[model samples]
Target: MKDIITNIIFWVVGAIVLTVEFTFKFNDTLGWLLTTIGVILIGIGFIYKSKKPFKYLIEFFINFF
Candidate 1:
């Protein structure tokens, strides 16, 4: 119950921040960057939930870099 409530609160706060970003003439670039990061996080969460091996992917990138 506590976890669910916390998750709901977090989502609400995130939504409010995004809303403020749009309503006020703040830094658009920073807002876009935040949105992009949020998208990446969602994708990663999906991949992790699906049991995909992400460690190998990270290792491959590390090797390339």
Candidate 2:
């Protein structure tokens, strides 16, 4: 239960990071770094057992475009 909440936080934060990267340009290395970290966080969020992660990803992509 705690882990679920924690992972959800991970997912949300990652989504935010990705969004920021796409919404605003940053220093080249900084943008790449944030993107890499954001992807890693999203993967970490998916490591737990739950459909919520997929739902979050779907919503993120849908809203992203």
lDDT of each residue in 1-65, candidate 2, tens digit only: 88789889988999999999888967789999989989998888876666676786688679989
Pairs in steric clash, model 1? none
Candidate 1: residue 57 lDDT (0-100): 56
Question: Which tens-of-lDDT digit does each residue in 1-65 have in candidate 1?
Answer: 65445545555555666566567636768878666555454444434433344875576569989
Reference-based lDDT, each prediction: 0.56, 0.85
Which is the leading candidate under lDDT? 2
Q: Candidate 1 versus the native: TM-score? A: 0.44
Displacement of the residue 3 alpha carbon in candidate 1, Å = 1.3
What's the distance in Å from true for residue 16, model 1? 1.0
Identify the runs in model 2 with alpha carbons over 4 angstroms from their true place: 48-65
**Candidate 1 displacement at residue 39 in angstroms:** 6.1
How far is each candidate from the true structure, as Cα RMSD in Å? 8.4, 4.7
Report lDDT (Cα) of residue 7, candidate 2.
85
